[model samples]
Each structure stands twice: as C-alpha cells, then as structure tokens.
Target: MPVSASYRWSPFCVDGVTTVAVKTLKENAAEVEKKDLLSELEVMKSLDPHVNVVRFLGCCTDKDPIFVIIEYVNRGKLQTYLRNSRAERHYGNTHGKSNILTSGDLTSFMYQVAKGMDYLTSRGIIHRDLAARNILITDDHTCKVADFGFARDVVTSKIYERKSEGKLPIRWMATESLYDNIFSVKSDIWSFGILMWEIVTLGSTPYPGISAADVMRKVRDGYRLEKPEHCRRELYNIMYYCWSSDSNERPTFLEVVQMLDKLLHTEMDYIELERFPDHNYYNIVNLSGEKL
Candidate 1:
C-alpha cells in the first residue's frame, strides 16, 4: 500500500471479496532494525475492536519480511473520495460517486474519527501522522482510521520528542510540533482540527497557495485558514478551538466526540455497517484526483 521513501505498507484482498492489508519489512532483524515496526505490530495486534478503528487480522514477524495483516478498507483514502465526489458533481459524471456525504454523514464520520483518536490517546498512543488521506472508508460508508506508518505509543508521562530529520506535513503540524519535534495528544488535537477542515471542505488542500517551507512562518504569524464557505458556523467554531495557539486550549478527542454528539443530536452509539470499495478504484488519486 505504502513504500519506504518515507513509509512502508501493503493492502490487498486475497479473495477479491474479503480485503486485507499489511506492513512488511525484511524479516531479518525487523524487530531489531525497526523497533518501531514491532511496536506498531503490537499496537495493531492489541487494539480492542472498535467500530471506527481499522481491525487487525494477524501478523507474521518470524520470517524474512515481517507481515502485519489488517482488515482492508475498500473505499481507500477519504481525501480522494471527497475530491472525486466534488469532481463528479461538477462534471455531472455520476458513475461511481453520485451521492456525496450529507451533513449528517460528515458529522458521523468525524465523530467516528474522534472516537478512534480518543481510544488511542486514552492509552497514550500518538499518531504522528493524522490526516484525511490516512483515514479509510468502507463500502458501507464506515470511516475507519488507517495507516499507522508514523504512529507511536508514548511510554513516558513526559512529552515525546524526536531529533531525527525528515520531511513532514508542515501544514497539518502544530506549532510546537514543528518547532520542537515534540508530539503529544495535544499535537494530535491540532491535527484533528486540520482534518476537520478537510472533511468540511471536501478535501481542500490545507493552507492553499502556501509553500510548505513558508507554512511554519505563516502559522507562526497567526494565519489560519478561514472557515470553508459551506461549513456550518458551529462546526467552524470547533475548528477554531482546535487551532488554538495553546495546546492546552485544544479539546481532547473525547471532548470532541462529545461536542459532535451534541451537534449530531443523537444518543445513538453505533450503526449497521457493510464493506464496499469506493467507485474511484484503480486511480489511487489525491485531493485533486492526481495519481499517487
């Protein structure tokens, strides 16, 4: 599914009906070479089943390339789906994507994401990468958090900081995270804000017209993206709160879930779900339908 230019993973359906995905590494010393891989495998294997979270099937770390098997979400990335839906509507090409997510659909999907993140943060797990593209959708309109390629479990009560050098999604990063390389549930909350924007805008690029190198400066200068034109005022208020300069000012995922629940105006906990692939198959597209 993903490669190690910056990541590694594989998603395929063995039977063409039941889908499965995996993360593999040279079995030789995978546990040693990439200790994170082992930790990730453990996280995957240990996750308690949840409606909003991706399901882990099994893993094989004993061989040359260790294998981490997980339930394959057929609809693929959320960003691509949004983009395609917008495009199909624009061009009137109602083939694979005709029905876009309604307000209720958006609310439910975001609530699911919040629930998944709350589960992880409650356990002190940090998803270093949190973005719409990392989220997957099933055929039945279920949103499942996917792609732990950059996830980590916080072993310390203190902040988790790294000194490594690599490219990162600057637009989606919190100010402290970009400057200090410190990651926490707070940083994740900041990312959740950006993710909400994505969902609201139907996959609009964050900080459009800004270069990645300059995003830090702009954000530092208090330049947050304005509310999406069609976004509800109440939801936009939540986004604003999420982008608070102070990490402590950001709401926890649990709080987010509660807020969304109130907005959704429902006490219902879960819904019936079924799995089906998105109509945008074979063209693994991005926010703009560009081939990945």
Candidate 2:
C-alpha cells in the first residue's frame, strides 16, 4: 500500500511483514529542508534503539533521491487513532467494541512513551518535536515515539545552543521555550503535558484556530488550553503543572511516569467517573487488529 498525503513523502509496502516510509531530499523538490532531515538522521543515529522508538534500519543516500529507511508501523500514526476515537465518541455507536482505548489503555501508552523518552534522555538526546503526529503505534497496540525529524543531540553544545535559539511548535511548546527558545529536560516535560492532553482529548487540535504568535502571547500571559469535560481533574492538574512557565518547575519524565502510574493503579472513583462518564465510553472498542 502507498501512503497518500501532501507531506512530501510516501510509504510503500516492502513485504507482507514490513513496509518502509521514504522521506526524500531531492534537489528539484520545492522548499527542500535538507538540513532538517539530515539533523534528524544524525539524532536518530546517535540514540540507541529501543522498542518504543521507531527503528532506523538503514538509508539510501548515494542515489539522486536521498532517503532514510525506517521501520514501518502497520498501525499508522497516533493522531489518526485519536481522530478515529473522537469520531467514534461523537458520532458512532460504540457499544460492545473491543479495541477502543480506555483510560487504562491511554495510561499504558503514556507509560511506554515515557519509557522511550526516558531512554532517549539517558542517552542525552532530546526529541524536540514530541506531538501526537510524531508518535506511532504498532499492530500489538504498542506505542513508539517516531519522527526524529526534529530531534537534536543534547551532547553537541553548538546544536543545543542553536536549538535553544527558538524552533518550537508554538501550541505544544513549553512557556520557557516560547520566550527564551531554551529547552532542557524540563521543557520536554512541558511538551509531555501537551502530549498527555492530546491523548485524553482524542487528538483535538491544541489551541485551535489560534495563530502561533497568538498562542505564545496567550501562554505567556498565563493562559492555557481548557480541559475537556471528560478530562480527569487529576490528569488535568498534572498537565497544568507540566505547562508551568518556569521550566524548573516542570516534573521530570520519571516523575511523570510515576504520577501516571499512581493515577492508573489507584482506583479513584470520582476521577474515573469524571474521565469516563458511561460504561459505553470505556467500551468504545479498538478495531485495529482486524483486517480493514
């Protein structure tokens, strides 16, 4: 199958068990971001591979069309799943479904993501872009952080300085990054908050209809995206803490994992009810394993 989109790349099935997504940096392509792609490759190479990270199998650089070979995820992007979930919740009949992600499923996914980030952090790598779109899921319902296209090696001082010079996703960026273009492990925590929000909100657009500049302004002015009605207060509070203006105030990735663990393991009747209103909500069903 060939993935279709206007994002300047296509995914093709390589074999029954494997597929490859090729991101080409061609001379004739319009607005080629060669540096960005190369930087991503460099970052991916530096970090040790983990199951929670999309594996970098190989690349094709000698040919005219430079391409990076990566492990293909059969399930596609996390954002796609979120959008589907949102649609099901809003319009579809979700009774007796078996594959839908419940709060527990989300917690498991978050833990996996955190484990991946923790591994990256231990290796002194920072995923500069940590958004729903950048995360990919597998056939077995495992979550992996992908799209190192924006990642940077933390050990390189010059790269760190350059990365700190701005370059952030406005809506998902931490407040400190918005103002100073500075990112440390702490700023990543802020991004994690946004990621958590995305998972819970079923991939709703962050700061919807707002310009990047305006998002920065509002964030600086102590504004944050409102929690959805179904969002748990504890989870929302955790997200709020992650968005704290002071980068130092944000929790570490391990801390985030612990918090999430607590939330997932401890059965808080109120929070559970608030997060999932009806029995039908938790039973929305995940149809990913079935053949489409």
Per-model TM-score, in order, reads 0.83, 0.81
lDDT per residue (tens digit) for residues 69-179 in model 1: 887777878878877766654566546745755667777778889999998877677887788888888778888887775677775763678655555767789998988
lDDT of 2 by residue, 76-171 (tens): 788778667656755656578545567777777777888888888877877767877788988787889887765777765523433423234666
Off by over 4 Å in 2: 1-7, 13-17, 30-32, 93-98, 156-159, 162-168, 268-292
Q: List the global CA lDDT of all models.
A: 0.73, 0.69
lDDT of 1 at 117: 90
Number of backbone-clashing residue pairs for each candidate, in the order shown: 6, 5
| Residue 170 C-alpha lDDT in model 1 | 74
At residue 6, what lDDT does model 1 achieve?
28
Alpha carbon lDDT at 143, candidate 2: 88
- At residue 110, candidate 2 shows an lDDT of 76
